[model samples]
Structures are given as C-alpha cells and as structure tokens.
Target: MNCEEATKLLDGYLDGELDPITSQQIEQHLRDCRT
Candidate 1:
C-alpha cells in the first residue's frame, strides 16, 4: 500500500485494532518511512 493508506492504518495499529497482516504491513511502512 501507499503512504496514505499506511498512515490510515497506523492509528488502529497503535490501538491494537488491526489484524496481524495489516499490523505487520503498517509496521513495515513505519520502518521504511523512518529515515
């Protein structure tokens, strides 16, 4: 997914609402975007 999509999922992830797959994707995105 793109940055916006990843960002949208971030909140749910922080709150532990996302599934494993989605949470993993979001984590990967965060790592990639972290400079």
Candidate 2:
C-alpha cells in the first residue's frame, strides 16, 4: 500500500476497526515504510 492509503487507514488501525487482512497489510506496510 502507498502512503496515502495507509494514512487514510491509520485511524481505523488504531481503533481496531479494520479487518484482519487489511490490518496485516497495514502492519506490513508500516514495516516496509519508514513512516
């Protein structure tokens, strides 16, 4: 995922509102990205 998408989803991630697959993707994205 790109920065924009990840940023948009960050609130959901923090709130635990996203699905497992999407959360995993976001986690992986965070791991790959310096942000």
lDDT of 2 at 34: 78
Q: Estimate, for each residue in 1-35, the C-alpha lDDT of model 2 and write its tens digit.
A: 98899999999999999999999999999999976
What lDDT does model 1 reach? 0.84
Candidate 2, residue 10: CA error in Å?
0.3
The residue ranges of model 2 lying beyond 4 angstroms of the native Cα positions read: none
Model 1 quality (TM-score): 0.76
At residue 3, give the lDDT of candidate 1.
Answer: 89
In candidate 1, which residue ranges exceed 4 Å CA deviation?
Answer: none
TM-score of every prediction relative to native: 0.76, 0.88
Give residue 6's lDDT in candidate 2 (0 to 100): 91
User: In order, how many clashes per candidate?
Assistant: 0, 0
**Which candidate has the top score in lDDT?**
2
Worst 10 residues of 2 by lDDT: 26-35
